[model samples]
Structures are given as structure tokens and as C-alpha cells.
Target chain A: METLIFDLDAKPLREVNQFLHGDASGLNGKAFVIENPNGAHSIAVGLKSDIHVTVKGHAGYYAAGMNQIAKVTIEGSAGSGVAENMMSGMVHVKGFASNAAGATANGGLLVIDGDAGLRTAIALKGADVVVGGSVGSFSAFMAQAGNFVILGDAGEGLGDSIYEAKIFVRGKVKSLGADCEEKTMNPEDRKILADLLAKSGHAGVNPDSFKQYGSARTLYHFHVDNAGAY
Target chain B: MSEQQPKIPQTKPRFSATFDESTMSEIRRAAATGIYDIRGAGAKRKVPHFDDLLFLGASVSRYPLEGYREKCATDVVLGARFAKKPIHLKTPVTIAGMSFGSLSANAKEALGRGASAAGTSTTTGDGGMTQEERGHSSILVYQYLPSRYGMNPDDLRKADAIEVVIGQGAKPGGGGMLLGQKITKRVAKMRCLPEGIDQRSSCRHPDWTGPDDLEIKIAEIREITDWEKPIYVKIGATRPYFDVALAVKAGADVVVLDGMQGGTAATQEVFIEHVGIPILAAIRPAVQALQDLGMHRKVQLIVSGGIRNGADVAKALALGADAVAIGTAALIALGDNDPHLEEEYQKLGTTAGAYDDWHEGRDPAGITTQDPELMKRLDPVKAGHRLANYLAVMTMEAQVIARACGKSHLHNLEPEDLVALTLEASAMAKVPLAGTNWIPGVTGF
Candidate 1:
């Protein structure tokens, strides 16, 4: 597996598609660089194989949206919807990511080096998005089954209208979202997050620094008096 | 109850009209045909809304901030450039996007003038940006609708910010529909469609289907503009938490949430009232989504629909909205349903308070009316100035409340500063009871 270099000056989209349009599936052993990323968004979207795509600088919206099975990483910040609707893959952001990172994702590991914007991992079916920093409010709203772990403070209304997804936060939450609630930290949570952190390269993080939140299943179905106002 | 055996009345009128002869005649005509009661919002009945949510005023516990003597910050920034410049508004209360085809050019320009005068922004609606509106408004936000009518590079580059109109509060899942009756020659040209064609704007973006595509679409937009403009995703307030998250994921610089009470030029009445959440209910979740991302204020959040006056603005801010946008209120300021048009409204078969027929284009007031005569009734200069005054008052009011709440800036208003008048208000506001600290935690407000 030879390393492929895509300089910022080079428009790799055509070439990258050349390989993808063909059958070059796994680019893991190769180091791909989108040099001087400078907010060039969507480096590799909808790539359905385990390839490694490293965006050197900032990438714009949906940096790696709906990624199927590729391991896509960005060196700098990512704009909104990084790894959106991603179906099974690994996405890493060395810097901050805009709102809704890993939204509606299923079966993937999304790691953000820094903070994430609002509604990160919303309605996540099975994706796991680990943030190195804080998250905005309503993170993981209506998330059915996934893990959203935040290392920094959580914004107001965290986890409102969530489903069965698990949320672990190391920081303070301004408020909880409608129908979302704090749950008792069980041993399963501790083990799962610890293993996840180690696998995602945050091996030494203190698991105790996090708290878990999820839906109480009260607002999912509307009641006349308790009709879901949202 | 039927013991009296009410005899079947002979074929006559549906009922005797209690209204005057003219009103009866109009009703008879409407009955003889069809298509009556053509307005927006809760046609079934009225409810106390943001309009009814009044402030407690200066009292023993609070002091009134000077209306004009004090330094009240009203500036608001929205949308990071996708390829261009971010939008900068004079006040937090912006005029929401209302289409050009749906409204007369003078009316659109009036909104821009009014918004500019008050030092705020006015947004373009489903119909792409109009040069007249843009030239008039200091801060003009161009909207990209599902229809994509008149969309091209020049307008995209010219806009301060671009709003991706995924949905609206009035009819979230529906698209822009201009009945053939409303389609004019100029509208046809601007839209690049034949004149007098009933345009059923695609309910969804013709090119992009899901969020994944939207992400690319947003990037393409950025590329087209050379990364100088900010992108905003405007969603009708339905499943706000998820939508907010999706919007954030979509890389929106701002997430604009429009509530159920939002105004629509043309949409099914049922959809307007039956679908979507209220602006009050939508704010907390949206703010929370930002907070969850650790980008609450960093990725600005603007809320609209049912926002009226200073108190509603303050409440939205306190509830976690970075800024507020108004459509109907701005229209009212431009004389949408002025009582002065009462007789004319009667002729239109609607009352001032009962008006909802924005789609008819027969508005006696120039606000929503497209009739040349009706549009002429509203002097753009005068109406524009009036809108400015009203916007100023709203900004002042928000600032005063924020100051009283001990925050120097309007955006600093928070849930801690408010108490709800009713449990419904309290719950919707996500605030505690007026006299109690307890929120039904288990039930969850």
C-alpha cells in the first residue's frame, strides 16, 4: 500500500473518484493528505470501503457525510454534518467540528479532537461519536441506539427527546432536552465507554469524568395532557 | 332534545345573515361558489399566543431600563460565509423570508427599508433574492428553496447569507405553490417559467434528497461563492431536536427554527395549524442542540414564528435563542391588518382580526395583497418607516427586559430570568412556575 499525497493545490476529487470509481477499497496502509485543507469540505463522501482519507486542514460541511466503510480523518476543523448518515466507518477530526457531527449515523466510530456543534449524533441508531471537548445543547436528540461521549461541558437542554441511545458527558449541562433524563451510571456504561475511548485513541481519559443521560421513554408517544409539545 | 321534532326547513339560505347587506351579499357569493376564509393561522379558533405572553413590567422586584437613554445593544450576526460574508443585522429581530412573487415588489422593498431603518435584516423567501429587495435591505439573507426558482451564481454571490429552506412552520413538508391565479408576467419571467402557469414548486430540493446530499450541496454552494458566505438551515419546528442536530451536521452556520404559528402565503390551512411545534416549544431544544455540540452561541441560533413585541423576543432569547425573526409582526408593522382597512376587509369577506387570506393577492392592505390597487394603498416609504419604528420599539423592549434581567446584552437573556404566567407557558418556556422552583421533572416541561 503506497502512500498517496494530495497537495492542497491538487484537486484530488477527480483522482480520488478515479480510485473509488474503480475498485481501490482499502487505503488504510496508505497515508492520504488533503494538504492545506483550508475549509475544502466533503473530502470523501459516500465512500463505501475501508480507505484512509486524511484532510490536512479545515474541511467544510459534511466533511465525510454518509460514509459507508472508510476511515476518514480531518487534520483541522470540520464544518457541519461531519459523517452524517454514515453507515459503518471510522471518522476522526483532529480539530473542531460544526453542528450535528455524526447525525443519523449507524455503526461507526466518529472521534472529534476538539468541540462539536449542536445536535451532534442526533437520531443515531448505532454510531458512536466521541468528542474531545464540549457539545452544544440537544446533543443526541431522538437518538435510538448510539453512544455520544463528551469530554467538556454540555450545553443547555442536553439529550432532549432522545431514544435508547447512551450519552456520557464529562462537563456541565445547562439543561436537559424535553423527555431526556439523567440515568444511574451502571457498570455496563463504564466498561463500554472505557473500551470505546481506548479504541478511539483516548485511552487514558478518566471514565469517572463522565455522566450518562438518555430518554425516559415518556415523550416518545404523545399523550393528550402530556402530548409531545415538541 | 329532538322531542320537538324540528321540521325540515325548506331549501332556503344556510342561515340568515346577522351581518349587514354587503356582508351578506359577499357571504352569499362565496357560498354560491367556493374558496372562502382564505387566511393563515388557527382558522378553527383563536388562542393566546406570543402576543398574550406579556411582561410583568417594572415593579418592586424589577426596574425599568430607559427606553432610549441607555445603551441597548441590538446587533446580531447570522451565517458564516459559505463562500462570502456573514450577515450582520442592526437588531436581533430580523424580518423573515417572505417570497417576492407572493408579495409585490414594493412590499418586499418595504420590508427591506423597514428592516434597514431599524438596523436589522430582512430575509428573502422561497422565491430567490430580488434585486429590488436586496438593494433596499442593508442586510439581505437570500433563501434557497426546494423550488430553486431564479437561482443562479450572481444572486448567491450578492447575498450576505444564504438560507436553505428545508421546511417552514406553516407547512413543513409541503412546498411553495402559487396558484395560476396569482402568477403574473414578471413573476413568470423571474422564475423562468411561462406566464400564468400554476407553479407547484417541488416539495423537496430537486437535486438533493437527504442530509448527506445537502452537505455536498452546501459545500458546492460554498465553492460557487469561494467560501465567503455563511449558510443557514431553516427548518420548520417539527422534531426540532433531531432537525437541529441534522442541520448542525449539515454544517449550518445558523439554525433557524420557525414555529407552528408561523405565517404562510399559500399552504393548506390544516397543515398550518395542525403541524409543527410552537416557537416557544422549539427554542429550548434547538439551543440545547447547540449546547450539546459545545457551539450554542458559537453557531448562532435564530428563532421565528409567533414572535411579537419585546417580551416574546426577550423570552426567546432567555429560552436560548440567539436572536429572533418576525414575519407576521413585521407585516403588521407594514399595515397588514390595520383597522383602517376594516371596510375594505369587509368587502373581502374577512374581518381585521379574522384575516387569513394571504394567498388571495387581493389584500386591501399592501402587505400581502398583490392587487395593484390594493398594493398602491400602502406607500412603501411610509410603510417602511413605520416598520422601522415598530422594529425599534421591539428592540428597545427586548433590551430593556434584558437589562432588567441583569444582562447587558439582549442575547444574554436566559431561562433563569423568567417565570411563566401559566403552566403551559412555563412548560413551553422551560421555566419554573411563577412562585415555585419546581418544574414537573418527571413529566418534564
Candidate 2:
């Protein structure tokens, strides 16, 4: 496979983005290596085609934003909104992620290998998120539709105002947010978790260790009794 | 015996000013339902508006042109500040943003068709862009709201312009709410939420907190679109002076100012009535801010809220706005709350003119509902024609006014030709009262 190398210290971000955005069809299915990203903002944003991009170092805000039909792997820590609004692609962060790691993404898969910061997957639409470690407070806030798998502990206020999205956690939980509570894990849920773990490259882990959480379905209609929750 | 007693004149029954009938009814309804009343539309309470301003037709000092012979220009160009391609409109009136979830697909299509026919731009609201709108509209402006629902880069590039909405006039600092009943499968899918669930949009954007961050956000949008589309910053009329100045400093090509009289799909009644300033009080301050920065007319201003007729449009242009946008009026022109639907409206426990329960998704006129049966009642083609006809009439009416004012173009109608009827209106519009050279709160009256 043809490989392209971009050294951030040697070239300006605009120059690299210009080349990347410009007709990259010749390098279809090729690998792109980015060195010294060094927590820069908006690196590899709006990538539309199917290709492989590997960032050798830490990436900054909105890294791999609006990604579609591409595979992006970050080797080091990632800043806020990594893989935001992604559609039909995969983004794997090998290290810790900052806040709002997949905010408002409609379709895609985001895999975080380390601890995720606050509000991870806030307003996430259909992106499947798998966090390998613990997450901060307000994880999965207002999540609509998706599967969020947490392998470790969770902080407070998880899944506030949550909708149809399902949450599975293997470790301890701090507390649940409004309209969110623990749900019984059935065989179908176990099967879904097994598939998610397999897709996230954690197939060795047992699915029986996880607990499921989702919306209580009480806030679907307006009622005066629920005014305090609002 | 009762008929005989009624023949004599009796003293008129006195009513309580503090606890009126409407107030007592509201209390009773709240006690019975145990929830605050939620509805659509703008404030019903009267406020100072463009109706308070009158134009002085030319008599001697100003020469009036022949009504049919004079050529009055109504063309307006927007976003010439930085964009390579700016918007050119045949008329100064454009359609304001109303989301797909808040309105039916047919309604959006009709709006696109009408705006295209009128040679003006139509905007996408909170939910995001729809194919029906893009396919039919000749010029479409995409709104970037705090919710960021269904926002993607591809659509941003496809848009003719981008409007970053900081606030709307109906609820300045409040979040938007879509009740569960209106959240159909398609709306939910577009918004990335569960079907039939109440969706609450955040009041503030997650990324930027202030003007400094706003600059970066605008830059990012510019980069995404390759600096092609014009960016507009929209704010509710709270502190128009400061907001307009800040938006200009943040590198906006256009500023959209919405006043408190603006209509909303759904919001708390209290917030809608008592949150922001009137448009009459807002335009002068905004224009002053633009002048202070030496950007007046350079940075286009589009004002909305209570604009109804061509007279309102002419009055707005005189107040220094480049153009005017209409929301409630546009919906009305599309047959919303039409008298023909009076029988259906009565079944919902309200009259057609008084109906405002749009959030429930049971719109009989089919303009604001997602239900397939209700939506089918509206023919986009017919509705589009009606809207186009209404727009044509408004434009003609404005031209008549412009000719009477002896102005060759609608933009030439200045505040000097206007006179206010009340002290408050005179101060708000910064114009003198009729038959008097004195303007209240300015100099010696």
C-alpha cells in the first residue's frame, strides 16, 4: 500500500489540509502518517473518502471531525470533540480522550482505549462508543440512539435526559441522572454487548460482567409531577 | 317580567382591572391541569411597533412621482463584506428560518418554491437541512444553532450562506423545546434522538462562550467552506448595541436582529412576552452600533419580529435595515390559521385565528405538522402560489409608498420622512411626533 507522510513541523497545517482535501482519489486505500500533530486543532477535518490515517502523536481539538468512510487512529492522547459528527467511519484513540469525545455524531464508531473526559458522547445520535476505561461526570448526556460501552467505572450524573440509547458498564457506577436508571440485562443485551466488545477489539473480555442502563421512559410525556425533574 | 325590566337603562357592570376574566381563566386552567399553558405564536399583548410610525406623503417640499409611471427599485444585495458570491434579491422581504421538525415537509417545500419565485432566500432552522428545501430553493441559508443537530460539513458546503444564531427573539436566553408528540421518526432521526421523546435544545453553544471564541468558530466555518459562503451572526434584541458591535468584531458579514415580537414554534408564554426589546427600539441602536464601527450598509442588517405588510417593510428600510424577514406572516400567507379551517380548529377547543397549539402536531391547516394525513391536506404548489401572490402584493405596495415619498429606490426612504404618534414611539423610533418638531427624550420638547 502506498504511504504518505506529513510532518507538522516542516509544513503548515493549511498546506497539509489543502493537499489532503484536494483530489486524494489517487491514494485510495493508502495509509497517511501524520507526525508531530502536537495537539493542534482541526487536523484531518472533513475527510470524506475511505482511507487510513494514523496520527503518531497527540492530537488536539476536533481531530478527525466530520469524518466519513475513513479509518483514523490516534496513537496518543486526544483533545475535545475527537471524531465529532462522524458518519460511516471508524476512529480509534489509543490514549486518553478529553471532553465531548463524539458529540452529535450521527453514524460511525468511536473506540477510546483509555479514560474519557466529561460529557463523552453528549448528544450522540447513532455512533457506537466503547470506552476502555472510566469516564468523567455527565457521560452520555442527552444521548439519543446508540450503544455506549464503558469497560470501567463511571462518574456522577450518567445519561441525564437520555433517550433510546443503551449503556453497558463493567465496573462501578457513581450515580444515575434524571430519567436514567439501571436496566435488566437479557440474553439479547448480552449478545449485543458481545458484538460491541468484539468490534472494539476487546473480544477476550466476558460480557456477563457488565450491567445495562437506559431511560426509564417516564419523561416521554409532559406531566406536572415531573416538573421537578425538568 | 324580565323583558319589561330590561327596557330600563342600567349602569354598566364594572370589571376588575387586576384580575380580569382572562387572568381568572388562566388561574383556573393552571389549577385544573397542574401545568403551565404552552402554545405557539407571538405575544398577544399590544406593544409599540411599526404601526406607530407614519410616513409624510410629499405635498410641496417633496415632489410626488406618478404612481404608475415612476420606477422604484426594491433590489437588495447581501454579504458583500468578504464572500466572493453575495446574495441578490428581487425584493427586500425574505423568509425566516423555521425548522423541519417545527413545520411540515410540504410547508418547507412551499416556502422554498415561494422564495424562489420571489427571488429571495429561505433559511433552514434548528433540525437541519432537508432535501426538499435544497432541491426547490434557489438560494438557501443554513442556520447554525446551539443544538448543532444534524450539522455536517457536506451540507455546510452545499449551503449558500451560514447564519450562526446566538438567540431568537421569542426566548432570548432560553432553550428550545419540541414536545414528544411532534417527534416523529424522521424528525428524531434527523436530530439523532429517540422518536416520541421531548427534545430540549441547549441555550448556549458548547464550543464558544464569548466573542473571542466566536472569532475562532467563524474561522473554522470559513475554513470548512473554503471561505466561500457568507457568515451571518443573529441575536435577539436584548442589548442590540453591544451584540451588534461584538458580532461585527467577530467577523460577521451580516447581522440578523430579532425583536421580542418574534413568533416561536413553542416556548414558555412568560419568556415570549417578557424577554427581549421591541424591534422599534432595537433597529436604531443596532444601526448606531454599525455606524460607530463605520460598517453601516457595509455589513447588511436583516431585521425580523412583527413585520406584516409592505408598510412595515418600508418602515424597516427607512430605519436603516438592508432587508426584512417574516416568520408568522409567511406562515399566515401559506394558509396557516385560515378561516377555512375554523371548523377543524373548533374541534381542538380554539378558533382558527386564536389557535396556537402547534407543538402538539395536530395542525389542521397542515403547515406545522408531521402527521401524514394532516400534511397531505396542504398542496405545496397551491400554497407556493398563494405565498408568491402575497409577496408580489407587498412589493407593489412598498413601491407605491416609495413613489409617494419621491424616492427612486426603497432604500432611499429615510427616517426623516417618518413621524411617531406617541412619546414612547417617538423616542423608540428616534423620530419627531406629527405636527411637532420635538422628539421626546432627545432635546427640549
Candidate 3:
């Protein structure tokens, strides 16, 4: 595979993105390295080809947003909404991530080695997220579909108003929001959890140590009893 | 009869002014059901609207052009500020966004065909873009809403223009509600939700919030589409002056302001009627915001809500709006609430013109239902023809008024050519009262 290198200090981010958005046939199966990111916003966003991208330094908001068929890795801490609305791609953050990581992603795999900020995986639609470290409050709120694996402690209001998405947490959960509750982890749940753990480079972690949580199915329809919950 | 009813003084069985029959009925219904009443369409309550304004035709001081002989241009160009390719329309009237789940696929197709034949644009709504609308519409504006359902970069790139929806006129602070009945198999698949689930769209975008953040969000979108498509920011008519100014600052190529009368698919009836200000009261402040920023015409303004005819279009333009959009009227043009469906409407316990239970998915007109049988009743070609005819009539009517005002183009109409019939209209529209030189709030007057 050919390797392409771009220095953010010398070249504008726009040129890099435009080059990446080139014809899929020529860009696919290639490796691109972004040096000296310096926390710029919207870097490597809207990628649609099967390429690999590595950000050498800290990145800002919406890095790799709405990404498709691409794998992106950030070596340093990322700002808010990293990999937001991603579809069918993989995003890995080697350092801590800010708020709303992987928000509203329809399909993707997001792995965070360090702690994640508030509202992680919110409104997630058919995506898989694995955080090796702890996560902030309101994680997985209103998540529609997919699976989330948390290896460390979860902050308050984990999985609020969650839908069919399955959440596996190894550590203590401070609280659960309305319509969210613990569930019995079956063999299928264990299998999926193990697969996600392996795919996110946590193959040695024990799926049995994690507890599964999901929607209680009470707030699916409007009812007077659930008014307080709303 | 023998004693003239004993000369009894009857009070004429008067109804209370505060609690009218409609109010009492609503209270009774609320007492019966714990949930707030949810319905479709715009505010039913009457407010000061276009009917309160009148055009001042040329007579002595101004010269009037021959209506049939002179050409009164109605063309409009939107998003000329930053877009590589702006939208050009033969008429200033466009179709407002209505979601596919709220309306049938045939209805969406018809709207596209109609708007295309009329040489205008049509917009997609909260449920996201559908192929029916995309394939048929000559100019399609895709909505990037809070829910992000069916939102993708490919579709964003395919759109002629992109509209970022901050809020809707019917329920500004509230999210959208598509009841379980409307979430059919196709609808559920499109939204990526379970079958028959009550889908509530979020009120705010998941990625960003506030005007400062909005600027970055717009930039992100622009980067995604390579700045090829125009970006529009849409807001409900709450604080039009501040909101429009902020949208402009946030790098919008066009600003869409929808007033209280703008229709919704499903929302709390109370929120729809009480939340936002009327379009008649919203246009001037928004236009003033553009003028204050020196962006008038440079950044086009599209106002919607109860814009029924050419007269309303003319009035909106005179008040400084570049164009007008129609939702409920367009639905009507496609045969919603037709008197021909009176029997079916009666079965649904409503009259033809008064039927508004669109959330139930039992539309007799087949325009707002997901039922295959009901949807088949509407022929896209015929409905599209009707809409085209209606649009043509509206364009001609606006041209007539513009010619009568001695203006060669619809955009040439100014506030000086209009007067308010009532004090409320005068203050809201910033126009002088008829037969007097008094504009209620203009201190110089």
C-alpha cells in the first residue's frame, strides 16, 4: 500500500481532505499520516473510501465525522464529537476523548483507550463502541441500536432512554436513567461482547465480569405512568 | 302562547366568552386522557395575518402598467451569497419541508413533480430525504435535522441545497413526534427504529449547540460537500431579529423563517398554537435584521406559514422577504381535506375542511397515510398537475398586483405600496394604517 504524508503546519486541512475525497478506486487501500494536527476542527471528516488515517497530535471537534469505509486513529486526546455520525468505519482514540464521542453514528466501530467525556455514544444507531477506560455521565442516552462495552467505571445516568442497544459495563454504575435497567447476559450477549472486546484490542478482558443493561421497554409508548420519567 | 310565555326574560342561552364550546370540548377531552392532545397542521387560532394588509394600487401620483401587456417578473435567486450554484426559480413561491413518514410517498412524489413543473424548489423534512422526492424534484433542499435519521454524507453531496433545521414553527422548543401508527415497516426501516415504535426526534442537534458552535457545524458541512451546495439555516419565528442575525453571522447562505402558522406532522396542540409568533409579525423583523447587517438580497430570506395566495406572496415580498414557502397550502393543492371526502371525514368524526388528525394515519384524502390502500387513491401525476395549476394561478395573481402597484417585478414591491387594515397588523408589519399616516411603532411617524 502506498503511504501519503501531509504536514498540517505547511498545508491547509482543506487540501488534505479534498485529496482524501478523491476517486475511491485510487484512494482505497492507502495509508495517510497527518502530522502536527494542533487540535484543528473537522480534520479527515466525511471520508468515504477504505483508507487508513493516523493523526499524530491532538485533534479538535468532529474529527472523522460522518466517516464511511475508513479507519481513523488519533494518537493524542481528541476534542468533542470525534467520529460523530460515522457509518461503517472504525475510529480509535489512543488518548482521552471529549464530549459526545461517536454521537448518532448509524454504523461504525469506535474504540477509546482513555476516558471519554459526557454523552458518549448518544443516539447511537447500530454502532459498536468500546471504551477501555471510564466514561462520563449520560453515556448512551437515547441510543437506538448497537452495542457498547465499557471496561471501566461509568458515570451517572448511564444509558438514559436507551432503546435496543446493549450496554456492557465491567465497573460500577453510579446511576441509570429512565427506561434503562440491568439485564441478564445470555450466551449471545457474551459472544457479541467478546467479539467487540477482541475487535477493539481487549481480547484478554473477561466478558463474564461485565453486566449487561438495556431498555426496560416501559417508555416505548406514551403512558401516564411514565410522565414523571420524561 | 296564551300569556306570551308569561313575559319571561331569557338570556338567549349565551355561551361564555372565556370558555367557548371548543375550549370546553378540549378541556373535557384532556380530562378523559392523561396525555396532551397531539395533532397535525398549523395553529388553528386566528391571528393578524395577510388578510389584515392591503395593497395600494397606483392612481394619481404613481403610474400603473397594463396588467396583460407588461411583463411582471416573478423570478427569484436563492443562496447567491456563497454557493457556487444558486437556486433559480420562475416563481417566488416554493414548497416547505414535510417528512415522508408524515406524508405518503405518492404525496412526496406529487410535491416534487408539482414544484418542478412550477419551476420552484421543494424541501425534505425531519425523516430525511426519500428517493421519491429526490428523483422527481428538479431542485431539492435536503434537511439536516436534529435526529440525524437517514442522514449521510452521500445524500448531503447529492442535494442542491442543505437546510440546517434549528427549530420548527409549530413546536419550536419541542421535538417531532411520529406516533406508532405512522411508523410502518418502510418508515421504521428508513429511520432505523423498531417497527411501530413512537419515534421522537431530538430538539437539538447531537453534535453541536449555540450560534458559535453552529458556525463550526456549518463549516464542517461545507467541507463535506466541498462548498458546492448552498447551506441554509432555518429557524422558527420566535425572536426573528436576533435569530436571523445570528444565522447570518453563522455563515448561512439563506435564512428560512417559519412562523406560528407553519404546519407540523404531529405535535402537542398547545405547543403548536401557543409557541411561536405569527408570520405576519415575523417578516419585518427578520428583514430588518438582514438590512441591519447589510445582507439584504445578498443573503436571501424565505418566510413561510399560512401563505395561501399570490396576495400573500406579494405582501411578504413588500415586507422585504425575498421569497415565500407554503406547506399546508401545498397539501391542499394536492387535495387534502377535500369536500369530496366529506363522507369519509364524517366517519372519522370530523368535517372535510376541519379534519386535522393527521397523526392518526387515517387521512381520507390519502395524502398523510402510510396505508397502501389509502396511498393508492392518490395519483401523483394528477395531484402534481393540480399543484402546478395552483402555483401558476398564484404567480399570475402576484404579477397582477405588482403591475397594479407600478412595479415591473415582484421583488420591486416595497412597504410603501402596502397598508394595514388594523392596528395590530400595522405594528407587526411596520406599515401605516389605511386612511392615515400612522405606523403604530415607528416614532418618526
Best by DockQ: 3
lDDT of 2 by residue, A11-71 (tens): 8876666566655576568789999999887777777777889999999877888788888
CAPRI quality level assigned to candidate 3 from its DockQ score = medium
How does chain B of model 1 score on TM-score? 0.87
Candidate 3 per-residue lDDT, tens place, A62-129, comes to: 99999999999999989889999998889999999999999988888999999999999999998899
Model 2 alpha-carbon miss at residue B91, Å: 1.8
lDDT scores of the candidates, listed in order: 0.75, 0.88, 0.93
The runs of at least 3 residues in candidate 2 whose Cα sits more than 4 Å from the true structure, single-residue gaps closed, are A6-15, A35-38, A56-58, A198-206, B1-11, B57-70, B206-208
Candidate achieving the largest lDDT: 3
Q: How well is each residue in B1-445 modelled by candidate 1, as lDDT tens digits?
A: 5568778979866654468574677578667755433345422324334543444445677665665576657677776523346777778898898988888888898999998888888889765678779999888888987655665445766788888899988788977666555667877656544455445565665335688778777765664454677888999988888899888888888888998888888776556767777777778778878889887877788888888788888888878888888888888888888898899889987788667777777777876755677778888899999999999889887887877665667876667777766667666666666677655442443
Interface RMSD of 1: 13.2
Q: After superposing the true interface residues, what Cα RMSD does each candidate give?
A: 13.2, 2.0, 0.8
CA error at residue B324 for candidate 2, angstroms: 1.4
What's the iRMSD of model 3? 0.8
The DockQ values of the predictions, listed in order, are: 0.03, 0.44, 0.74
Model 3, stretches more than 4 Å misplaced? B1-6
Pick by TM-score: 1 or 2, better one: 2
- Please give, for residues B290-354, the per-residue lDDT of candidate 2 as tens digits: 99999999999999999999999999999999999999999999999999989999999989888
